[model samples]
Target: MDLHGPLRDASDTILASRAIDGDLVAFEVIAHRHGPLMRVLAANLLGSELESDDVVQEAFISAWRHLGELNDPARIRSWLMRIVSNRALDRIRARRHHDDIDAADRASTGPSTEALVEHRMQLDAVWIALGRLPADQRRCWLLRETAGYSYAEIGETLDIPVSTVRGLLARARATLLLEMEAWR
Candidate 1:
């Protein structure tokens, strides 16, 4: 069977089933269908093109391994997205920890010039403001505002209840608005 040809007719459930049955071609179709969205999600979360690619690859591998465990085949998109989210979260945590270690080292070594330190401090302030947001709110804001995901699509991708997505997005906007007003 030419997997590509069948994929066009196959629903996500069908493709997922075939993939779980060891059909690599079927899995490839699933990957292709979802890859662009995955990249966008990863890039938004990681904030680096190269790191996003790494996160997406890891997510795909994870999906393949856990394919059999998916309860609702039709919900494959959301399941895959959840995997991507988890992977991205892991990457973000590691990056933040690395940054903290570097900052500690830099402090011990004496700070850079006053101008450079001031610029960095401003950047840190923005980052701290963003970091204060709840994870769901942050993810929703990033996916919708930065990644250009629509509400429904984001709800699907994040495996969030649509109402929950709306609430989180609203909260995020409120937070940003307050922060911006303070800056002014």
Candidate 2:
């Protein structure tokens, strides 16, 4: 049977099932079908085209390994999204660590130039402002504004109540507005 035949049948479940049964072609079909959306999502979350590509690749590998664990095959999109999110979060954590090390190295070396010192100070100010936010508020702001997730979707992704997501986002916006006003 043609690949699109099963893909068009009903849900991605059929394609997933075939892929799980060791059908490489079916798996490739599934990957190709969802790859673009996955890339878009990763790019939005990671904010770097290269990092998004790496995240998407990792997500696909993870999905392939755990395909059997997915109980509801029809929910493939959400499943894939979750994988992308987890992978992106991992990348974010790693990048933050790397940045911390770079910052420490720069501090130890002292300011080599006035311009570099000014840039470092600005980055420090921004970090301080962001750090002043409550963790939930910061997370909500990043996921909604940076990652482009809806409130309902953020609630799902974060395992929080939708009302809580709404409140946190409101608080985050208020805090940012205040900070921006102070800057000006």
Measured by TM-score, the strongest candidate is: 1
Model 2's alpha-carbon lDDT is 0.75
Which ten-residue region of model 2 has the weakest summed lDDT? 96-105
Candidate 1 backbone collisions, by pair: none
What TM-score would every model get versus the actual structure? Answer: 0.66, 0.59
Write candidate 2's Cα lDDT for 1-184 as tens digits: 4655645544577777777777677777777788887787789878888888889899989998998887777667667777886688678756643444345446856654565555655655655666689867876787797789899978766657999999999998888778756455
Per-residue error for 34 in candidate 1, Å, reads 0.8
Model 2 regions more than 4 Å off: 1-10, 100-143, 150-184
lDDT of each: 0.79, 0.75
Clashes of each: 0, 0
Q: Compared with the true structure, what per-residue lDDT tens digits does model 1 show for residues 1-184?
A: 4544848678998988888888888889888888888888888777788888888999999998888898887888878877887798778666643444345446756655564556556655656776889878877887787577889888888777889999999998899878756555
- In candidate 1, position 93 carries an lDDT of 61
| Global lDDT of model 1 | 0.79
